[model samples]
Target: MKLRQKILLLAVAPLAVAMLGIALAVRFQATQLAQHERALVEAAYLQSKETELRHYVELAQSAIAPLVRSGRTDAATRQAAMEALARLDYGPDGYFFLYDLHGRNLMHPRQPELVGQDLWTLRDPQGALTIQQLIAAAKGGGGAVRYLWRKPSSQQLAPKLGYVVAVPEWGWMVGTGIYLDDVESTLRQLDARAETDIRQTMAWIGVIAGISILLVAASGLALNVSEHREADAKLRQLAQRVVQSQEEERARLSRELHDGISQLLVSVKLVLETATNRLRLAPAEGAAVAPVLGMALNRLDTVFNEVRRVARNLRPALLDDLGLYAALQHLAREMQGGSGLEIAVTQSGTPRELPDEQATALFRIAQEALTNVERHAGARRVVVALAFDADATRLTVRDDGHGFDVARMQEDPQRGIGLRNLRERIAALCGQFDIVSGMGGTQLVASLPLARPAAIAHDPVSAGPSPS
Candidate 1:
């Protein structure tokens, strides 16, 4: 992957994971909390129903209190009590019921047909003995029991909570009950609302995660665009520098030919013309013409030597003939003779052959460093060291001169061209280049890996000279 894509992934992946984990945790906790709330609500509703049922049973007992307290157990008193209870209902589905100790129905206001039936073995859909459970609650000194029963209003079986009390004097079970469909309906609504809220929460988390990832990706894209712009600008600057350098080199060569070799050729031509005139005028003056011709031959020799010097400056033939070592040695000798600087060239490890492109790049780097030292460093002594290792080659140039600011010089486009060229050449070979300058001296080092070829076939700045 490209670096931009990797950066975006690194920034967004973790955030997405964390958001997903948070959503899951919220869903789990919300579900658990909803269940707990539902239990609390159901319990509270059932407790209220139990209390209402107990109150209805008390009211029924009050209606029959006069007969029971008057010590009457006759059939008429029993009939009167049953009639009173039959009339003592609160709502259409609310009523009091009576059962004998043997589970025979005594009085049932809602279902009159059940009043005379023996219902001890009767079971609801859930297999619970409904009448027996009610009688048991009465026999246990008045409490509540839950079971299924037909609701009078709906005429369908629904859950019921019945409260009952025992009347020992008459062998009767007095009870009242409230159907629980309303409580369940309320809880169902609550559960639906809770589910909707959880879904919304999860959706919001997803939206936030998506937005965060998009923001990070946008930032990475912006960074990549900025870097690309900077690279393009530097490339344009490098192209301009290459053109300017070529023009400057051509100008120098033109000046050398015009000022040195051209003058010598003109002097030689004048001497030859004088010798030719003398030979044409007097054949006996041939000895004088020979002396003039000899002078012309001497000037011609100077012109040839100057031409050789210019050609050597353009590209050293010694490099192709004997390799980098001999070329560097010759360069040091020539520079020392001209600049009067103590220049030394040394090598370490066994010599190794290199690709032409790599060798040429290194040679150019060395040449640029020495030129900088001679022209700007004002150094008395210079050392150039070349080392060959198992897998790499290193070149170091040091000069004992008053140093200049490395950063400042590199920042100056006009003054830093030579240093920049040296660095570019090393970079084209995929090598490491380092330069350190201070009041003490300046040291420039370039190290290239032997196993790797040049990243490019040629460097633009150093395209002139290469080993054959």
Candidate 2:
């Protein structure tokens, strides 16, 4: 994996996990909230049903009280009472029953067959007394019981809220109940909604995970490509440097052979000429040999001057003996002689000596710049300026030439080497380099930190010759 992929994964993995965790938490919270809301609704429904049932029982009790108190509680009166109770429809799935204080059923709305049956003898499959408990409570005081009730015939379980009231004058108890199965239907619907929400949240999590992985992969690929390009550029720069070093070495050797060996040969020729002239006047045939020696001498002088010029061109001794300014002046003068181009050099502020590496780097940059100007620029005027300000040494070279496009040159790898090298050299010195070129002219500017040389005893002679 590339570094970008690693970094992106490092950044995104935690977030993805956190998002999933949050999604799960949110889903759980939503489910809880939905359940809570459903519970509240069910509670409300049950409360409303309880109120309606209580009102219905009160109405029945008030209607039957006058007949029972007047001692008209015969079979016809009881039948009228049952008819009156049946007319008040409490709701569907509701039941009404009347029982005596002895726990015997007096009347039941749906099951008249058990009218005289003792309810205290009734037992559910769980072996629990059913009607006897409610009769005892009603005989003591009116109360209600909310419990699971089962139908004797079908034995189906259903939730019930039962209310029992005592009628001591009639020796009877009254009770009513309603089934709770309808409320459970609403809960089932709520559960279905919660399940659907969970599924949707999981789908969103999957989508987020997929997008995060794709982004990480793309970022990694991009980083790998960028690193490869940088490595290639560094390799090309190294190769260029190798080629330049080889050429420089060759130039140095050529200069050394011509300046050292050629000069010695010319001196030997001069000595030979003096000997030939003296022998001609002596008793020897030196006159004929003297002309040949003269011709040799003339040839030797030409060769010596050529050799000295070539050596100086390769690496000027004045650069080492004198300083950077003097060397530049000499270079400008020599270039002016050969190219017939107008060149000027200017300096200002204190002229302090620089380290050997710094001086050499600056000189080489200037040399390359001038050479490029000669080959590419078709102008007659050039200016090289050096100045010192505060702790910085600045150099500027400007040429009034038909300058090429700077942007294009920078993009062209083939033509950009010189500028790149110059930038690298300045960067190595913790300096800055900038170039500005257009159709009108071009300018190269560099600024280096003015590092003071080590303190040494000043010698007047050591200062060397000044610029002419």
Candidate 3:
């Protein structure tokens, strides 16, 4: 993958995983909590139903209390108590029932057809003896039994909670029950609502995650674009600088030829013309013409020297013939004589032949730094140090001059052209260039790596004062 795509993936993958993990954790916690809530709610609802059923059973017993307390075991008293219970009810499906010890239905206000019938063997759809369980609950000093029975209102067999009590005086069982379908319906609604809320929460999380990922992607894209634009600008600026440097060099050469060599050639040409005229006029007096020819020969020599100087400036022959050290030494000597400043060349480590490009780049970097020192840095002494190692070649130029602000100069195109050229030269060779300047002085170091080197012992070298 491309570097940008990889970076985007790195930025987004972890976030997506974390968001999904958060969603899963939330769902897990919410599901567990919902289940717990359902259990608590169902328990609370059942407890309330039990309480209401108990109250209803107690009210029925209270109504029949007169007969039992008066010691009346007659059929008419029992019939009157049953009729009173049959009339006492809270709703359409709420009523009392009666059964004797033998499980014979005595009174059932809701199911009148079941009255006076033996229903001991009767079972609900789940194969539970409904009457037997109710009778057993009554025998156990009034308790509740869960069984299936037909709901009086719907005529559908459903789960019911029956609270029963025994009237020992008449050897009869009496009970009432509340069907559980409505409780289930209410809990189902709660479950559905909870599910909806959970789904909504998940959706929100998904949306937020999507937005966050998109934002990260957008930010990365913006950053890449900004960096790309900056790189392009820098590239264009470097190209311009290269062209400018070439033009400046060409202009300098043109001036040298016009003002130095061209003038000398003109003098030589004039002296030759004068000498030719004298020789033509007095062919027999050749000794007199020798002086004119000598003058012309001297001018011709000066013009040749000027040509050599310009050619040396173009490409120093020492760089290809002798190596970087010799070229640097020659440059130092030339700069010292021209600038009338103290310049020194120092060498350390094992000096070895370098690649042509690396040698040229290092030389140019030193040349520019020295030029800068000569023109801008008003210093008395300058040190140019070259070091070699198994891994790389290093060049250092230091001048004890009042230094200018490095950042300020680098930002100013006119002031920074030389520095930028030096930097580009090193960069083209896949090297590093650094400059440090302060009131102490300016130091420029350029490091270029050799492609490969033979195994050789490295020397511990340091830069110090130049030899007087």
Best by lDDT: 3
Write the number of the candidate with greater TM-score, choosing between 2 and 3: 3
- By summed lDDT, the worst window of 10 consecutive residues in model 3 runs over 456-465
Arrange candidates, best TM-score first. 3, 1, 2
Model 1 has an lDDT value of 0.85
CA lDDT, every model vs. true structure: 0.85, 0.75, 0.86
Residue-wise lDDT of candidate 1 within 29-139, one digit each (tens)? 999999999999899888988888888898888888888888889999999999998888888988888899899999988888897899999999878898888888888
Q: Write the per-residue lDDT of candidate 2 for residues 118-179, one digit (tens) a residue.
A: 77777655666678877876877776666667644455886677777888877778878777
Count clashing residue pairs in model 1: 0
lDDT tens per residue, model 3, 420-462:
7788778877889999999989999999887443522232221
If both were scored by lDDT, which would come out higher, candidate 2 or candidate 3?
3
Ranking by lDDT: 3, 1, 2
Residue pairs in candidate 2 whose N, alpha carbon or C atoms collide under 3 angstroms: none
Instruction: For model 3, state the Cα shift of residue 407 in Å.
Output: 3.6
Predicted structure 2: lDDT: 0.75
Q: Candidate 2: where are CA atoms >4 Å away?
A: 1-213, 219-223, 226-234, 237-241, 244-322, 348-353, 449-468
